[model samples]
Target chain A: MTRPPPRILLVEDTPTQAEVAKALLRDMGLEIRHAETAGRALADALANPPDAILLDLELPDFGGFELMQKLRAEGVEAAIIVVTANASVNTAVEAMRQGAMDFIVKPYAKARLTVTLNNALEKRALTQELKTVKAQLSRDRFFGFIGASAAMQAVYRTIEGVAASRASVFITGESGTGKELAAEAVHKASPRAAKPFVALNCGAIPRDLLESEVFGHVKGAFTGATDNRVGAAKQADGGTLFLDEIGEMPLEMQVKLLRFVQTGSFQPVGASRPEKVDVRFVCATNRDPLAEVEAGRFREDLYYRLYVVPVELPPLRERGTDSVLIARALLATLSREEGKHFRGFSPEAERAIMAYAWPGNVRQLQNVVRNVVVLHDAEVVEPAMLPPMLLRAAIRPTAPHLTPMAAPVVAPVVAAAPVVAAPAMAEPAVAEPVPVQALPVPLPEPIFVPVPPSPPALALPPLPPPLPSVPVIEPLAVMEKRLILAALAETSQDVARAAALLEINPSTVYRKLQAWKTAGEIP
Target chain B: MHALRLQPLGLCHRLGVWVEPKVDRLASRWHHCHVTVLDPSIAGQLAEDLPRADFLLIINTFRDDLARLTQELTAAAATGDHHSFHRAAHSLAGAAAAVGALRLEASARLGMADEASTAPPPPGLSARIATEAQAALAALAALAQGPG
Candidate 1:
């Protein structure tokens, strides 16, 4: 009975149409129930569950969008097909966005209905399969790169594509989003896997000694160049040169690096002849290079050269349950290496992982899991094993539900299950709800007065006269808030630069940030 | 069950039961001992044209719009002219085909149809009007008895 023909709840107001629909479904060997109005439909759904719903867009009581939201609030997971007369792609997109499984235009024949029903069922099956596969692969890997989540697989695919290519690669994301590890993964997967994959923090090195260190000096290129040494670029000539924090590279050095990437030739500092070197350029930055270009800080041409086949890493907070998936994998890897037997996460630990904003992203996650594994004596890791900062951060409220951002990122991870699984897991999450408290019930009034010659249309809200009312926020507050939020996001909730962005003071941003330290929202 | 064939007349609101004189004439012929169903969306338009007369008719069918219909039916009701309200009830009676008070709906509909033609009332028209008037009076009396 559980796997019987997909049951569809047909919500149509007209009795004649409802009967016809029921007959069609009966022909398909499917079971159906009908409700006449949106209110009645919602009540019926709450009373008796259906596998899927065929909803008429037009109802005498309320619109489809509102009905879908009400259904979602009640936790009905039925696949909904919006049977509508409207054909605009916009309406379709809106319907899909509002959690409709699919949209079918009305006046459809029995054949079209069958096809739609089958496709919806198939997609449901595919989603369950994905979840199963994700659960299986979650116990593998180090860092937060666990599982064969399609998102991760796509990352792996992109890594494979550019790993052997000598062309420079740019990796971009907010800080702690695992840009460096991705570069390393590419290097490890490439033909040069056996060779040394040297990494240099471009932002960490001083400008004066950077060139000499990179190119190898004649023992006197700078104050600290007392001994003759090969620079990172030279050392990595036969391997991969991973430029971490490439966004912080000085403009002048960027020009030089750009030239080297272009010609594969560069002279050592104070050296006469340009030497040919076969090295791959892999760079990463937390900054949006396009924004840096606009600010006249980063070179435009250099940006394009390095940005070829750019890979963007999703931030940790948006990774949904993959946070737990990656954490579990990291725990397994560390446990085996450390010769410890660990079973699984305690309930509290799971809750912490689910709730944390994860501003430091994959790096932070990897560190937290490793720390928990190393410190915990029990067979399972619990909340107490988490860092004090993380433990405290997890309890704070995150503004705006994370579902909208999390669903897309975690979808592929859960989308790899089997062809034979139950399919409800793959449907998109319901859209954000309008505040019920703020909304007022609409009262029907006789607003349409019959005109002399034409049939009456409802009286429209009055149009504004000549000058439009425009409200502008005070410049200082607007700019400060923007800077603070961006800085907090970029630095993974680090208070310092978020303050600097305001330009008024880091101390002020820090003070405000301290008061507003809710988890995940800052990130 | 007895079925009465429908007779169509050109004049509107003819069954005399505290409605327009014309409507009252039409309504009495069909009111009581008949089935009448009204379609609100359609009856709504006609109600607007003869505001005063229609107001009294609405009060008769709905049985609670006395305050508003009193103004429209003042001239008729004051002189014991139940034509306007009768006409309104007759229209409502015609429209209430699916889910309204059946006997009342029938009487009102019959009343409007009878009032439509200028001819003197039909054989059962007078008796039907008296019976319907009693029912309408009882409904109004009950409504007044209930708490607002």
Candidate 2:
């Protein structure tokens, strides 16, 4: 059966411009669905999600950004290409950073639009392919590492291959991509597996003490050298010495390192003569060694010596759905540590994790899972339980296939302010809805809305006074004042309720109240 | 209400703007452009690198951009948004040059370099820009519709 041409939702306010764009895109054989207002667009997207959406930032009802946010929070996985006449570097950056696959400025060549659209579609196709691949992948856990992506498999193979060889192994990758674990894996697989595998972060140590930290210190090396300390090199003698962040090692230290790598000998700080140790060297750095050498920050000869057998670790973002595999593994570990029972991430949570760029890589992923497991508890880890940063990473329009009973149907309430529509429920909407829940505000008391019983299934929670769901950028003082005012309103001016809502001590609210009275900002 | 809302915002910028009559002069004199709407060299390279459909898509984009930018120039001028005008001009210059609309690009280059000493734009500058954009649009439309 032939698949229908990929559907594209073009959300633009201007009819003429939309017509022009629609005419232009029609030639590409793409079926274009045009929605001029944000509310309509939101409804259209939810009703029948397109394969890709070309969004205009400035919509008639509300900003298209708000609609995009809602779609993402609802876990829409369609590829989005944001189009804006208000083309500026800032707008382009924010759009892409918030999950737009691509951004095209106005007056763009039809060629540019097509290229962006095609690329987004291609990316979506690849992501879908990865999902299938992820399902088929086996051996999700390897050694101390957890990942089932082809990238991780290659890394495992590299570790196994390099382990038997005595040649110096150099690992490179961005921070949190598990370079240390790779080194340890290499050591564990090596002939010297029984021996201790000592590791040291070269960048973490102070410049003046790096030499002592790596090569050991004699009894009277410096003023603070209280006792003779065996350093990383001596400690890892007859085993593997993993020097992490090796690029940050001072130039003078590079000379010693080059000498050490050349000959398995090094003098301890303030020691009389050279000492030889059969230590296997495994160096890792989170920098471009060649670029460092070119910039004169790193010694050219030292780079060549250590760049011998390089094993580059891929960043978490490039590892496809390996994030899901790793997240499951991490959740299991974290839940055990926190004494929480989490079977795994809810599908939406998993989808969100998979879509995130993971700029901090595995370390960031670990921290997020640990934090979620520690503070929140549920049968399954949901998106709301994750950090605000992850919550903000609701881009990459994927399908929210699960017919979730709890997802608040995004019904626009007011004609004048379509942007402020939110869930008419007490329990939060999934996609972490908005930062509204993050504010220290208590839920309104039941007395505020006297509800006569209807069908139990038909009843919805009473809605609060609407707040704009769009993320706001404001100064700290303004935000604090707003929070206090909202807290007061939500709690009906009850001081205790307000304080409890704010998660602050009652006395702190009392002090704030008095200060506001003195300033006459509050009546 | 004799409306303040109806009146244009800010006045100092409107005091010293200049309109180059050259654009009107340029538009009226238009016939078959001595040079092609697009640079023949860039087009040749793009044709070799891109599919025919992709090439047409580009031409269509250039034509649409010209229309959009012309619209933006007018809106910016009416609102006394010189900053918006500057950005539009800057983008117009880049897009015009990329498609090889030499005359339009040259005028847009001037707009990019404009200090905007006058708030939004002087009287007629917006119209002048629109003329250049329209001429470019016609050239591009011809280019798009021309035999591949």
Which candidate has the highest lDDT of all? 2
What are the candidates' individual DockQ scores?
Answer: 0.01, 0.02
**Alpha-carbon local distance difference test for all models:** 0.60, 0.70
* Runs in model 2 lying further than 4 Å from the true structure: A1-137, A399-523, B1-148
Candidate topping DockQ: 2
What are the TM-scores, per candidate, against the unseen true structure?
A: 0.39, 0.42
What would the per-residue lDDT of candidate 1 be over residues B1-148, giving only the tens digit for each residue? 8886443321222323344344344454544324333322223322332233333343343433322232333343344444564444333342232112334444444444444555433334434434554555454334333334
For residues A1-523, what per-residue lDDT tens digits would candidate 1 score against the true structure?
1667766788876443454355445556777888878998999889987778888876768977899999999988788899865567998999999999888874455567778887886786677678666754453453325544555656666777787776677888888777888888878877888887889998999987677756667667567657777778788877899998887888988888889888988878867778788888888999888999999989999998888879887776655577788788788888887777887887667756766667677787888887877776568887656654443234322212111221111110112311222234545333342222122221111111122344212111111111111212335444345545654665466454333222234567666556555633443
Off by over 4 Å in 1: A1-144, A333-341, A370-376, A384-523, B1-148
Interface RMSD values for the candidates, listed in order? 16.2, 7.9
Candidate 2 C-alpha lDDT tens digits along A25-72: 766888889897889888898998888998988664688778889989
